[model samples]
Target: MAASAGPVLSREEVDRALARLGAERDAVESALLSLQDHPGLRLLDGADLTGRTQERWAVVGQGLPMLWALFDRYSEALASARAVRARKPRPGGPELAELSELLTGDAVTVPGGAPDGPQRLGAPARLVERVSLDGLMDRMNAWYATVLEVVSAADAVWTALPARIDLLIAELRRVQTLAASLGVRVGGHPLGDDLDALDADLGGLRTEVRSDPLALWRPARVPAQRGTVPDGGALATPSGVVDTERFDLAGRALDGVRLELENLLRLRDDAEERLQGVGDLLQRADATLAEARRARGEVLAKIAATEVPAVPGPASALRERIVVALELRQSGQWYRLAPLLDALEDAAAKELARARQSLTEVTQPLAVRAELRGRLDAYKAMAARLRVAEDPEVVERYEKARWLLWSAPCDLRAAAGAVARFQQALRPAPGGPDDGAATGPADLVDAVDAVDAADGTQQGGAWAGGEPADGQAVDGRVQGGRG
Candidate 1:
């Protein structure tokens, strides 16, 4: 009995103990792998396992419970291996080296185990102690084959779970970026609530797995077979366990991605629609502006046509007469034809008035043109008014002035120029004599009164010349006498 007992272990026996555990893990792993190729071991049917395997028809129902137990045990061993790996001392440490040796080398005896004897698995009544490699391999292989079927069935569910999560994360980032660009919050229906839910579920699953990965080692209870221990529930069975919750999470993530993508597509569609409408509106506005410009051009053309022909004739005649009068006066001969000179001044004034009026009328269309000029000036003034103006009022006043200059009823400057021209034409010729006997003043006043009465009509027709009333030229040069 003493020889059968294993070597004793101490507090510092951690390395040796871990090494033994590793050997045991490896032994189980090898046995499970060998069993994969075994024959005559019937796969468990409905009685085999839980979760996904029970639905198959080829596996025997009687072998399911054992298979379930075998797989459960295998899961436990795998989880232990992961835990031990996590806790192993640093590389190059004696403990780590011991664990490595146990994993790849011969089994080590520890605590109560025999140093050179076969390892005792457990109490003889609890489990078979010296299972034949061939026999056990055959049994495990049959059981695992059924579990492999379960693994295949659950593959999409398991694999898709994490994939869905990854996709969800990517979509979430995309939505966040889009929301930022549009200057909107992310709390609305697009991906907000769904993302929140998925995040929470994923966090919970991660926490659960971190807390105890071995929790999955327990056999899953089938909804239909509540209390029965299926044969396939054995930990040593070759059943592949999948993280189903991960699949669920992934499904949700995929759903979120789909929804988010749909939202993005809709946003694009809406932007396109708005852009189309804006384009149409701009086209209409451009067309309207073009028509207005054409109309303005036509108006200006008419004014020019009316005023052009009359300009040269009257203006030139008046200038020539003024020059003649000035020359006569400078030669000290103006007293003889003082009345004629006065008449000339009056005629000159009338001609100037007409010229001015024609010019004013021709330029009236420019007020509309001036409107555009004023707007441009207003834009220029915007920078200067920042300091002097309290607000935009100065800018506005400047704009209004410009509008007045350009808009319909001609500007004050235009009207004033016309009046000034008329007044200038009424002035007595500079070299003419200022004698009381002259009817020049009276005739000129009457002419102005007539013009005033006619609402300042532009003079174009011949004037009524003042003479001796006997058909004699007042200045001895009668060449129609301004009539």
Candidate 2:
């Protein structure tokens, strides 16, 4: 993994760094002691020490020296323990009777060789010792590196302590002044009376440092309550303080105020805009109400002009009866009369819908007059077809049907049935009668002829009454009839 960038530590932050390193060193020391007392290492036996066994023993031996170094650096008591352990022998009787006999007087038996009593321990023994010693040296090197790092961090913190104290003092003072201006009181706080107490504390620190520069080096001498000081001495500076920490804090506080002010201003503007919209809506509503009143008057005039007789009482009473009949038809209860009623209902519905639409159009803005005109034109077009029917009977039947449909309290179903019958009778039968018999055209013509003949006879009799007398009469019949 790539190394992450470390925190940007000011001089004051460095002292905090040193304090953390000291704590870590103590934890490391504790870990080393635990390793030393591990039961497996203490139980090591010397029988059949193969290459793999040798490697394991070498690791323990190598680790011992580094452990010694770590103990030496971090704990005086542990260092003394390590020294005693180094001087001690393995936990068993000696493998050779005497050190001199094993080295010079005795010859060891050589493996896979004939009757040489014993061979001298030489290169293999030396190699085993070297491996163990190397492991011990590696561990020591690691401990040395760790101790150096801790010392470096501590020294750096000590060197920068004075400047860090100055910065912290300055920041505290600035915070104090602002808190006072805002009327904020840290009541009952152990850091004394708000910003004032903090300022005194910072001043005292600065005076202590000037007199004895080493005062800042000691962590215990520095006030533990420094963070609790409300404003310290930094906040008491003038409006344009050049210190970075104070300036940054003030900017943040002012930025929050600026945001709040902007939000309130935006809210006020939005409220004004909404108020204007409401006024426009009210004006439109008033205009619509006025138009509705005028249209209502026009509808009353139209109703009054209708020549059809009122069925009975108020128009509302008649309307109620129609509504009841419609409801019955719609409920599917009027099975026998349903077809005829349905036709009448359709016509009534169309007429009512048209009336309502007309009322709506009258109330609508004048800009919509074109739409109203188009609807009227469509209605007139529909009526024109009925007016110009070729058969007069058909035309009469249609007119009667329409009248029944629109008339209040009329027997709408019966009227629709009659109209349907008329329509059926008007249809010409194929190749049966092409003489317009359905319309009774021939009968109508004959009736007209008979009426004409009767009128002539009457005229002739009146003429005879005023004429000269015809004397001859035969069998009681007039001699000169109109024929």
**Candidates' lDDT values, in order?**
0.39, 0.35
Candidate 2 local lDDT, 1-483, one digit each (tens): 112133233333433433443344454555455444533333232223334334334333344444455334334422332343334343112222222122222112112211111121111322112111112223333433332222222233334444656665666655554444333345622222534554565565444433333222323321111111012111111111112343244335444533433443343334334333433443444444454456545434432222221111112433454555445434432322233334444544444444444435443322122222232233233334323254576567556655654444333233434444333333334444444333454443343334335433232232112221343211122221111
Q: Indicate the worst ten consecutive residues by lDDT in candidate 2.
A: 233-242
Estimate the lDDT of model 2: 0.35
User: Residue 46 error for model 1, in Å?
Assistant: 34
Which runs of model 1 end up more than 4 angstroms from their true locations? 1-168, 179-190, 207-237, 240-246, 249-257, 275-483
Candidate 1 vs. true structure, TM-score = 0.24
Clashes of each: 43, 18
